[model samples]
Target: MGSKQSVLQENGYTVMSEQHNTIMLKNKDGDQFIIKKLKADQNEASDFLQKLNHPHIVHHKEIIKDGDCLYLVMELCEGGDVSQKIKQTATFSEILDWTVKICMALKHLHDQQILHKNLQPKSLFFTACGTIRLGEFGVIHEWSSGAQITNPEALSYIAPEILKGEPYDEKS
Candidate 1:
């Protein structure tokens, strides 16, 4: 479980796999989690997770820091992302169910004044029990009033007004 520079071993999580800067781990109780080492000092995602409590949102267990790496311990979605699930054969009811779940999650986020700037197929994950959960809050923004923010990294999912560089509210 010891990588060249990872401290997951000290935290009681066994390394399952490593990809680039992220590692998948599982604890002794058989609970799996994903650990992502951030390259910068950012707490937006952690803050959002801590403030949110919904069934359709991915859960954040804890955050660990070892030297320069910031490891985010999150619930492991065994069913993977929705994009992969959509590519497979599914019933109409199943599709509708997933859509409703996503809408519920979005409504919750919006009610909290949190905008998921990066809304895409990859950001939608499914838990082991097949519950849809919205994830990937790296580009989430907290909005109030008519404030506008820019997200060049989320070009694919960015709204039209945002792409046009227009100052828009949370609806955009």
Candidate 2:
């Protein structure tokens, strides 16, 4: 087995920037991608990302477990995330367009019995073509017997039932 950095290099990916657990990589062809280092408790989330595949959702390309840390390679959205767009003063039409696309992505996730517990502006990304792509599944949970609260990092984004320590279904 090779080191994580070596493996990525051997696969033709060069590190462009790294911040905390997320690394931005660029292949020899200049195509960019992101690699998220998953903590031990986030194993299930990695699996969920692999199982999820929708045009509006960020695509999980591969999973590489290097020693204690698990890394997930995902499609990169060159157009940046929703928060950046909002900071730039997005137009009303652009906001409406993003809203519909976000709803579509959420509906798809709900249909798959998955809950995106963290649905803040930062979680929504845009491709180079301006298409919305939902990412950040750090708090994803299976909707079995309703979803369970995974973490309190995004308390404001959490459902009321979850904050109350009550079971939260997809509707919540």
Candidate 3:
């Protein structure tokens, strides 16, 4: 409705950092959040993210449409992503716990006939409370029983069938 800065400020959020299309924000109450700007062409992915509701998934608080861009407001994960965590003293127990959490999230998405076409260590974020959450859902797609959905841009972490341009279901 307004300039992205003014709109976020009016909603009690102040920009903390920004890189590319992603902006980190903080409210007066000390709650942190992330806002990812999606171009008009990525509306389907944006719409898919808005419908997700899961404890292990980055919560989509709201969507702000500013001109041709869609800003997705979501909870902040201060603990960084699994990639960074792996570099630290990642204990066996921690790895096992994270694995279970990730599986749970994947199961949730698969059960809904949705496929997270881009799943990787960097996509798994950790909150300040150390809770794992699935993020970076730029290539998620709603799949039918026999429909083929593939994201050529996402080469890594994608199934072989997707890379081969073959029809793929949730299993892929």
Candidate 3 CA-lDDT value: 0.84
TM-score of 1: 0.84
Candidate 3 stretches greater than 4 Å from native: 144-154
Q: For model 2, what is the C-alpha lDDT against the true structure?
A: 0.84
List, residue by residue over 31-73, the lDDT tens digit for candidate 1. 8898767744556556677678899998888887665666888
Tell me the tens digit of each residue's lDDT in model 3 across 1-172.
6888988888788999999889999889988889998887777677777888898999998887778887889998889999999999999999999999888988998887788878888889999989999999877777742323344455667788876877888678
Candidate 1 lDDT (Cα, whole model)?
Answer: 0.78
Instruction: Give the number of colliding residue pairs in candidate 1.
Output: 0
Off by over 4 Å in 1: 1-6, 144-154
Candidate 2, superposed: residue stretches over 4 Å from native = 145-153
- Identify the superior model by TM-score, candidate 1 or candidate 2: 2
Clashes of each: 0, 0, 0
How high is the CA lDDT of each candidate model?
0.78, 0.84, 0.84
Models ranked on lDDT: 2, 3, 1
The true-structure Cα RMSD of candidate 1 reads: 3.5
